[model samples]
Target: MSTEFHKLLFEISEALVTDELAALKFLSLDHVPRRKLEAIHEPKAFLEVLQEKDMIGAGNLFFLKELLYRIHRIDLLTAHLGSSREEMERELQVLGRAQVSAYRQLLYGIAEDLTSEDVRSVKFLLQKQLPKTKLQENASMLQVFLEMEINGIIKEDNLTMLKDILQRFRADIKKKIDAYEEKKKENYSREEVRYPVSVSVYPEEQGAEGEAAKQHGKIYKMKNNPHGYCLILNNHIFRNPRYNREGTLQDGEAVKRVFKWLQFETVEYMDLEGKKIYETIKEYSKKDHRNMDCFVCFIFSHGEKDKIKGVDDECVNIDDLVSCFTGTNCPSLAGKPKVFIIQACQGSVRHPSVAVESDCSGPLEVDASPLTSIPDKADILIGMATVEDYLSYRSRRTGSVYIQSLCEKMELLCPQREDLAAILTEVNNEVAKRELEGSKQMPKITSTLLKKLIFEVPQ
Candidate 1:
């Protein structure tokens, strides 16, 4: 909004040529969506788009400086941004400062180093993967890389195909790929949450804490940067229109925000079928979770007594779902805490409210589902929205009573190092006092965890 800032951007935009503009756009492909970048032709227009995206503005021009530095525009950097090459280098070196992903930077760097002939050679090699229409003669290396990403030929996690193509003709460039992968692996390992895996109780663990930790006898290790994955399976629309679950999206959003704030790699799978839901769980179970400290799952859908119905109106047995993470099935998570939060009606009946004061009063809907009776597995905790054969309450405007309360309680108590069992007890107490449709909802927590599960608060 500053007039001086707009004048500075306008002057810088005047200095950039077409190719330099293309290069700037390529370098910024990670931060801005591809579809958005495709519409801009002039440098000033691109700068305006970046401004709209909050990528550049007054007192927030680091990304613009990075773009200029990458484009070898030191004159513009010095004159307009009042920054030098050395200053940008030092700032970028700080951990988590760069907005662009390292993976995208690698691809752009490779494209810049390649000649037109080299790009044609690369496109010829990718003939089998992408359609011929996308690999036309006028296609640039950046475009070819975009095609590879869109076609699943390459990704941040998997770059084998790109390396293979580069190694065939450009062995020198292939070496860069090797170095990048090695450095990435080192960084990932260093970033993982590290803690002792042994479950044996230590005196120091028990002696330092107050009544909360003493009550549980021992504490679960959650020393990793991201304790573990918090997978949310939200079924909003069912194949049978009448079974559509309203307000479940709110539940997923609430949990996602809380878990991400708690430093967990929160992922959500929306509107999955029964079979897909099982497969999703199995897929996660197969992943190597050695670097993680704990695993949490949230399932929001319709259900019967001991079964949850997917969007396809097909039911999955609650027992079978939990079985996917037994010690034998997911060895890496054996000693780590595994938590499941269920939001569904257990039965058709409603629990009678015998309260002195009514706390929960609002428009209510039901998620028409489990916990408890899990197999003999240690380090697993299950939180159910309601007791067996009882209906739980959810609001169309807000989320389900149990999940919202649980997220709030975690945000409040986890910072104080309160164990999860104690946190869920607080959720139980909170939800039990509320009256939804004149009926009380009591959340249930069934845990085989032998130790107190406490999350470390970020400083």
Candidate 2:
């Protein structure tokens, strides 16, 4: 047997606390005597003897397998030894639901500054964060998170929400400490006065390329200005690192440039994990964008049927991404265009193989949920790279099929007074005509536009 296999055998023995002779008797092997198994001191040798005597059968293996399975540790079995750590990762992904992950990070962040004596306070904070019933159910999970924080992995990149929560907690803690210190001081200096920082940058209007548009019995210039903000969230690296996206930065650059040319102040956030994506949107939503005209957000990341993976490998629902900016939540951008362009596979399903002379075509079924039922809010547009339940192709050399075509079409058509819907339609047609890895792709756009939004280019 290979060295890893031998090592696995020894590890399994260490995991099983039953006596060697008792374990052999439990196996109920007819050929292997309890005394002969007792002569073997090492687990590897015992396993070898079982194989040599041809005593390794399904029934005999169950004795060991059942013990491991009972503890939910079957992954430590010899056949799965090498991938045991991966099993933990998969479990964490499933366990880290969106709300749970967010709260987990928050708790982890607060726990970092806590001392051994602060355990009671930490537990109290955990209870305060959730209701009593929910806290009871998550008690064990919270213990695991506390262990992860002590190990130094909880504060890493994937748990930004936690870190951000920690930051807020730290600030409050510092304030309390400072207040206490002030009371103890007899002669303390007055707090320094700080003035607010200001900016001189103002919105510049790009003169209309042609005639003005008539609105409310008035002729308004068809000029575009930096009326609002454009957020570009591009996630490439992930906790597993295997799913790290290449050529995504190029796609983000294309989006930033196009949005900048359209006079929107483009802000780019790179390599966010699942919770941070929501947190970032929520943070941005809190900002007053009443002075701005429209809002646009672009996401380039790996996706599933109806969700996108954060760098931490957690999946977040796509509707939650848009709903963060809905008029109800973010009233500053209300009644203005809120556009989202997502470039991720809608599902795992691939294109069907076709015969040259075949006249019958089969309908494609996506195994994932439909990317629909976005809240019935006006002025929201969602642009998906592919139709429901299909993969969106990206090249290691160039960028994604959808983004490249979308940018090219936008640059070509935006100056011509084409509405965003019309421009995206052209993009869909352009992407559909191209084939990647022998599969065709068509983009999907769902919109509730109250009016036509055009990025009027300067002459």
Candidate 3:
């Protein structure tokens, strides 16, 4: 390795050694098996051991890069590891393709091994057939395959094969469920059942009333103008020398304009550290929302999977940010729609392009808030720029693909009295049509609401 690269690695190793808990998590995530971690104090020694033991595999490099980001040493990653977005993704692609092939084989093996005994019961099958414990082992490529399979996004043949195996398991579970219910002389509710056999299927909304229920609440109709506060935590600029998110100001301006047009009082935070971001939200959450009809928050920043970065490079989980305004945490906002528009990359994985084309807080008062919260059960809509573990594009010239399309869609649709979900669906469609260097982008929305959210001009 080059001298400069060696120096960077040494610093990282030293940092890890000093942070025992973080080191343990890192080791566990990457499966770096050693009797103890204390002996690896220097980078050179660490590299040697990893190589000798075959612990530093290609699959684990993805997590290692994320580890660098989590610890705020991305500068070291770029300087020494040649991990520019393109370079790193190229490496990941090679490893990803290989892993996919291996996982296909693994799936075949599992299919062959699935005997009648394996599907004896749902509980037993989940614990036995799927290797559930090992699935929690690391953020590996195999997990991606499992998610794709579960979501029915894999190839039809493969999906059919996987489903064939699962069908046996499901059938056996249903038999068991039937027997137990017969014994009790009653049918059990779906919610009351504890079986992994249930496959979630969302029914299509029928008619305006059904669509309206999914969009926003009946309270929206009682008010002429939307009453709520919109907070824009925009981090266009960064303290990290390696990062510069140009055109992000446009994202902030566009969101501010839209929410303001929606008649919601809006506040924008230009650049904040992670703690300050937490503090701002906490303070905002404490405010009474008795008169407000809804809440909107837009977070624009650099991010990794499940977390966005503050100007100072500290990472904050997106879940933590949204939970600050959950019903239990901010009771004043209960029964109201809380919308979060997040503009950030969710992971390091890059979509393979077949062709061509275009495209908080406050350090002064650290937000000692916990990194996670009990996810609110209802009335929360998280609009992520991209699906988890994928990149969301941004132009040095024009803002992000997702936010720009979102604002444009809202601008056009809001005037027509269309609901938020409809507009977001249009945004997703518009973004799906766009490509950057042959790579596609897709926005995702996770909503739990009982009413339609339509922002109409005040009479």
TM-score of each: 0.52, 0.50, 0.49
In order, candidate lDDTs are 0.80, 0.61, 0.61
Q: Is candidate 2 or candidate 3 better by TM-score?
A: 2
**What TM-score should be assigned to candidate 3?**
0.49
lDDT of 2 by residue, 1-459 (tens): 457555656767665543433433323322356467547765556667765653333223422343243234545643544334444445335311111123233343344445554444444555644445533433443353534445554442345433334345455744433444454352223211111112212123234422223221121122346756889989877677667777788889899889888888899999998988887876786677756778888988877766777888777888877876766456567666888999887766665433211011123336655545764877788999987767777776577878888899889988777788989999988888975657787789988876677776655
140-229 per-residue lDDT for model 3 (tens digits)? 333434444555555424344344445665555334334433543432343233222212221443565354444332424425244788
CA lDDT of 434 in candidate 3?
73
Which candidate would rank higher by lDDT, 1 or 2?
A: 1
Name the runs in model 3 displaced over 4 angstroms: 1-226, 351-376
Candidate ranking under lDDT, highest first, comes to: 1, 2, 3
Show model 2 residue runs off by greater than 4 Å: 1-212, 215-225, 351-368
Candidate 2 differs from the real structure by a C-alpha RMSD in angstroms, to one decimal, of 19.8
Give the winner by TM-score.
Answer: 1
